[model samples]
Target: MSAPAGGRRAAAVDPTTTVSRVKAADPRGHWFLLAVGMVLLACALVLNGYVTNVAGETQAPAPATDVSTPELDDVRSGGPVLNLTAGAASSAGPAARTVALTFDDGPDPTWTPQILDVLRRYGAKATFFAVGSKVAQYPDLARRIVAEGHEIGNHTYAHADLTAVSGWRLRLELSLTQKALAGATGLHTTLVRPPYSSTPAAVTLPQWQSLRAVAAEGYLIALTDLDTKDWSQATAARMAKSALPAKGRGAIVMMHDSGGDRSRTVKALDLALRELGRRGYRAVTVTGALGMPSAHQQAGGVERFTGWALNLAQRASGSLTAALSWVLLAAGVLTLARLGLFAALAWMHARRTRRGRRRRGIARWEAPPPVTVIVPAFNEEAGIQATVMSLVQTTYTGELEVIVVDDGSTDATADLAAALGLPNVRVIRQPNGGKPAALNTGIAHARHELLVMVDGDTVFEPATIGHLVRQLADPAVGAVSGNTKVGNRRGMVGRWQHIEYVIGFNLDRRAFELLDCMATVPGAIGAFRRSALVALGGVSVDTLAEDTDLTMALCRSGWRVVYEEKALAWTEAPTSLGQLWKQRYRWCYGTLQAMWKHRRALIERGPFGRRCLGYLALFQVVLPLLAPVVDLMALYNTAVGDPLPVVAVWAGFVVVQALTGWYALRLDGERASALWVLPLQQFVYRQLMYLVVIQSVATAVLGVRLRWHTVRREGTFGGTLPPQAAPQGALAERHPDAAAQP
Candidate 1:
């Protein structure tokens, strides 16, 4: 493809085509997963609040007058019990010798199945007043209850007490239970049992009023005549004794089938049925004995839809809960593993430093050989002069030549360098190519065996080049990486970057060098052997991180890459979040590209393939992908879980990181005060970096090609470079017309 306007090429591959294919293949799976996770998190928070509230509150005592029983005469006479209100009913009062057995608070998968089996064994029919939420959870059991000639009634949505709740809540409880029942079994019931109310005579005035209001909504309020109190009993015999009917009168006997271990209830049920049969009384459903109306009614259109929605919600909630649990578990394991690795690596680096110092004793100094420095610039007029002047003023006694390659800069970068008129400094102009292309041009024109590459915005110390070249004396060493520091640390963003350079980059480089798996000799300040650079085809253009790509290439070709700590290069860091985000995004995306391009090394026989590749996969790819999840879990724990433990764990990790940072600073001879910002950096800056990595991964997955992101420089390191004077007979003074052109 031809270069676009302003000498920048549009990506060779069409990003839209790749993005569309990715979307077409699995359009909504990721979106659905994200939605499910968010919903589950919200549900967890709400549940935590509810449980906390319930645990803290005290239960209200039942009134003494509410314990009275129905009159025996009224029970035998039956037929709606005239003393009851309009919406309420005491019993059916059958003339035949029959009794109704009703079980409440269930549809529990474990206990409900046992109860169903017992009822089926004997020819008995019972009514189950099930909590709506339980029915939604175990809809199969609800269906089995209806299929086996049993009646199902509404017992409120959450087993809420109508007497204590507001009228709106009472109605909502009834409606939700009805909807759940309809959704679960495609059927609805008219029987509504208000929780905590037994016989009609025992109902309080508020409950009576609620029941009358419920009757207006076309539901019959059911109050039992017999209270087995099976919930509090510990044995079958005691529960059976409580459930026995009084004087052979037809009555409704209340029992429980769920809400805890129900083995005793199940055992008592078997005994109760046998004893009732021996007395010539058969157990029947409440409506069957009462001769009112069949409670099993098919749901209407609206109710059926409501049932379907409730069923879907229950299944989704359950699946989401399980998935969230696994994600949180994985996040915890990964977080701990990362912390341990950092500590181990730091320890190893310290030991290696101590051992090297003791073994080498006092190091000897030597004069370095001739070297050529390459500075590639594109619209970097602001800092080009300082960069070139830093090279001219280096303290090394050996011969050094500086080549400034201007890659189609529309500014005065080329003119500014040429205006200095230093005989050792030369300005080379090229078409608007990218950084890698410019570096290649400079490498081709270089006059020395050793080459040093530096960014246009960077300034080096006087002894930096001399120390950097000493590592090349060992024939096995192909390149050396210099220590890079942020020259502008006045702003919060700059300070954070400064700490990261020391702790994250420099510390990691030390460990990587010891293991012979150094990944990247950073573009800001790295020295390369000419023969090694040529063997790798000189700076690849296939990736955004050409430095990393070339470094890996040299390592694969049997060359050692080392870090030179004494050689320091101060570079201007992006001050704004937006600029920083763009820079890091490009760096991350480019590194991924380079790693993928060299993926074959994973199976190769040497250390480059095994150790370096393995490290990249574990730390660079996997950890970055999982970092966001760890942050989310931390936030969740702080909000809903115990904040102290979360805070303690977070603080502990920060302390470990701070200690590591302090050690890195000591090694680099930096100020320890920079460590204070390390704690606050976790809140915003660290999150931003991981998010950038996430975006890069997402972009890579979508196969989108990103154009080069250019950072506008403000000459942050201008003060560090010595002033340069214009030569008396330079190009600007001798040929004014030639220098006037843009």
Candidate 2:
């Protein structure tokens, strides 16, 4: 039964030398991508394909065949077009009459396999230009595409129309896809298909040239001659009508096998291929379709290509140098931004600590103080019932009243309130002056000495109110804030936002807690002392964001705002991009308005005042809206194959940030999944923060005003979880009566 020596040896293969395999979105995948990107970043962005098309003289039109064909207007009596172009033909072959059967938007789990099976049966090879995100989702399929003797082309990170995104963005998009694909396969890509087959037109002359210059370094275009229209039509008949050719002109048919359902496309491909076979014509690869020169010519062309290897290498070296320089510049800028934010945060923290520390002291001496809950409700009828009902069900011991203020709701926002019929919950109606005005009105009428503000559409844990109130018991604290999270987790959008909240609000709050100035107690679940709130003239609706205003005012008044991580509330995140944008726009506008409204606080140096000096340097002065622009610049430098050293600098900083974020989550005893996800939070998610900051600055500079109420899809919240449909590991289930007896 014992294995032979050879078999034993095979079983005992060396583990140390094995290359680790990674799945898509794997931590290793992310790190691997970061590393390869950094290295390729040094190698230059020329590996991505960009086609040069000459439309005019004096301008280097996209070097789309600088040797313009006779048909092109830009080409003149340049006696020999090929000689006029003055570049060697691609080592790929003499592409005189070849058309590659390229598949765009594919490697789908369903149809890709079928296509692969067909290609396998035919023993044919073709290039597959895949989207980065899709490839990221299905790396194995991408690997298989390459393994089966198919060339992999860069389609884009997202299938964005690159032609429209001319200039730096276009180049950057190509670079991102190329880098990601190369990182995936460890082989640089030299082919690309812009989304929608978009090409740089005459309007973007420099962009075209830049794209061409980058492409010339390595990649080549497999331009299309025929349209498949698979994604558009999708029906088998329509797909056949659009795809099957009339046996005349050899074609490069465009097809999609991914991005939603492509079953019909798959069925159509079978019919089309069979019909083509039935005819005298053949269905062959692009290389075969274009009669390529023999093996010797291919070898000779490769040999000829080696002649310019040194030149390409030099160009790569130059590009890497440029990239390193850009990275350095970016790091410097980001450092300035980080430093400025730090100073601002520190100043803000100092003021909060001055007030909060005393409260901490008070908590040590006495039982927790009572809390005033400020519920700033705009037009939130969709989910207010569940939110209020949940509040009534909380098991808190503190004397807390939910103050619901109507902020010019055009819907049945006010009607929903009276329907709830709770003794402790008080309803206040104010003119639709916006959130701040409503909060100010509620603050004025609040009966409790302590004020706690919750969004009318947010639900709380049974103990969240008590936990938040206890934090404020500390006499040193002017206010206490709890965690706000997405309660509605029905879609990919909600889950993504959930992760964002965990990474941003959860981790950032902990850091802020450590610093002692927990900035704005979100309007969603903020508890403030009545006097401290009134002292700031209630929440000032003059500013778009009253929460930010209140925090700054508390800082100015030497009041400490403490972050109570244990206090948790669940709220809805906007399910759509448009809604999210509107919410952020209002937030940005409000932040700017509040900053200007309380500009005096920047100069003041009280426990609250002096802290603002740091605030100014760290937040408002150096970094405020610059992060995104800096990122855009970094991406641009990368796209142009420039030397940028800032990538490393930011890499280190983000690593530290991610580690800190993980630590904060650990301290809070949150889900461990956040640890793995925090790093990605920076790559894709932090960019959102950059947008928020920019919008804030732009709104301030432009003096833009935003209305509070945003349109919403009616009846979009709190559908009862169907039988056996409850979420896995959901929060403790409450009886129907737990909220309010329906």
Clashes per candidate, residues 3 or more apart or on different chains: 1, 61
lDDT of 1 by residue, 220-336 (tens): 656787788887845898888777777877878888888788899899999988888888888888888877678888899899898778767765655655676687667566656
lDDT of 1: 0.75
- In the range 1-742, model 2's lDDT, one tens digit per residue, is 1111122111111112111122222022343544575566433333321211111002212433343332332312211101112243222222333334668876678889888887677555666878764554565787788778776766766565554455566566556555444444545565565555421222133333443444554455544655677767557877766655554545566677776677787777766666655554455554455553211111234333442342244335445555645765665666656534544553454456457655643254254455556676777877777667666666665566777888667878788886767788887776665565666677667777777778866767666776677666556678888878676646655656776676556655655655654557787787777766555556654665668877877766666777765567777777766677677766766666766777776566543444543554455434535454455446655655344555775676666656544554455445656455555656755566555655555445544444453646444446222232222215435222222210
Model 1, TM vs. native: 0.80
Off by over 4 Å in 1: 1-99, 158-176, 194-217, 226-233, 301-306, 361-367, 395-397, 514-516, 606-656, 659-663, 723-742
How displaced is residue 218 in candidate 2, in Å?
A: 33
- The parts of candidate 2 lying over 4 Å away from their true place are 1-371, 489-492, 607-657, 674-688, 709-729, 733-742
**In candidate 1, what residue range of length 10 has the lowest lDDT sum?**
13-22
